[model samples]
Target: MHTPLSDQLRILLGPVDLADIDPGATPGAVSHEQTEDELPKLAARLDDLQRRLFAAAQGGHSTRRVLLVLQGMDTSGKGGTVRHVVGQLNPNGIRLTAFKAPTEQEREHDFLWRIRRALPEPGEIGIFDRSHYEDVLIARVRKLVPPMVVGRRYQLINRFEQQLTAEGTVLVKCFLHISRDEQMRRLLARLDDPTKRWKYNPGDVDERALWPEYQEAYRRALEKCSTDEAPWYVVPADHKWYRNYAITRLLIEALERIDPQYPPGDYDVEVERERVLASG
Candidate 1:
């Protein structure tokens, strides 16, 4: 069941303005300190759910999988979410992909071709740090594709996601919403911290300059692609602890809803037990 807090952060299939969400706001009664304190328990629950799902798949009793798509501006904490929120899961059951600019061969095919290839198998959880939304997001913001083409890709994305759901994949798409000032602070911190300096990309500054355009691009993509099969949730991300807590709760709700169960053994349990005992 979704908690009231998860319900609060979800973006319904309709219009939404990035301005309406307060990046610094923590939902309900939860504070940053409270979220941090609660995180380990929530993460443990997530791990158990993932183990169940993976076990069911291993037993050939489950065909369902989860795909979590995270989209946000530079330094909006997608990496942090992956590390803190999802890092607890068994790596064998998780497929994490961080997308960058398409390679020459990827560009030669439809945008979703590469994305389709990376989807999780049955009972696995797939996480995309950035996803197919880039076809409409960066592609539109930077004029990498024509406006009409970008518009068409939106419909294609919707249809593709519909197909995914129909084929037994559950999709959770989150946009890590952070303020421009917050983004700047994070970027500056990256530059100042020697250990984090490797994460600093020169292109991030150029992309930051076009913040307004990217915001508009995201707004349009959210409106067009948010659907029954795969809804987009805009998570307040300026407070990293709150962000991780909110997402962890959301995923727990989703997994509980899925309710994956272990399969009964095909052979006779009594007979198997007797044979094993005799052998020992």
Candidate 2:
């Protein structure tokens, strides 16, 4: 059974020492024994709560926007979380943006221009599959860019996120930390299964060889980017199902705090009741 949200989250958001997490350890599958084998039930509860929060947000005339940034190595369930966790949200109020390799126009602009363009409007949730931190994480890992440039980018990202938070956008960054061995298992499974083969990339193996480098990059990324306004949550992702639960729970808590509500009725209470009775 899964841990109740209250219990599970008490552990999930506690202090994490990056040095103690072994990137090479093997993570097992998620268990539902405690949750009555009802992953769907838990997920549904989260969805319903989110909708209520959205309605409350609209009602309260709240301008808060939520930006959920997800980062992880390949096969860490970033795509799956997007498909499952946020899939049931009201499409009108949520925006899902995947930051891919820069296009010609995007590359011509500053690194943050595309991201700025994708920011969520008032009372909306914006999810970035991979976000501005990519410049720091991937670039530092591969040494694809100059050292000076990477250093500058990290500072820029921190300032960028700070600005967003200061402007009423609640930023939540999550790093999906998966074990090296489990990653290899998932990668191989993708290759062996024809239906799942599409997820495999030849570059995944190449990147697997640099697991240590990636870990170092992640350590630094979290160290530099986690802040009072825009904190980073490093989730243990060996178990995809647990990862999903953690994500849904995180979002639920955040939305509940925002406490979105429907707009008040414009009509007088007595008149409104009379109108309802007349219509009936």
- lDDT for each of the candidates? 0.87, 0.75
lDDT of 2 by residue, 79-117 (tens): 998987777577778988998988899988888999999
lDDT minimum window of 10 residues, candidate 1? 1-10
Q: Model 1 shows how many backbone clashes?
A: 0
**Over the full model, what C-alpha lDDT does candidate 2 score relative to the true structure?**
0.75
Pick by lDDT: which candidate is best? 1
Model 1 lDDT per residue over 184-223, tens place: 9999999999999999999999999999999999999999
- RMSD versus native structure for model 1: 1.5
Which parts of model 1 have CA positions greater than 4 angstroms off?
1-4
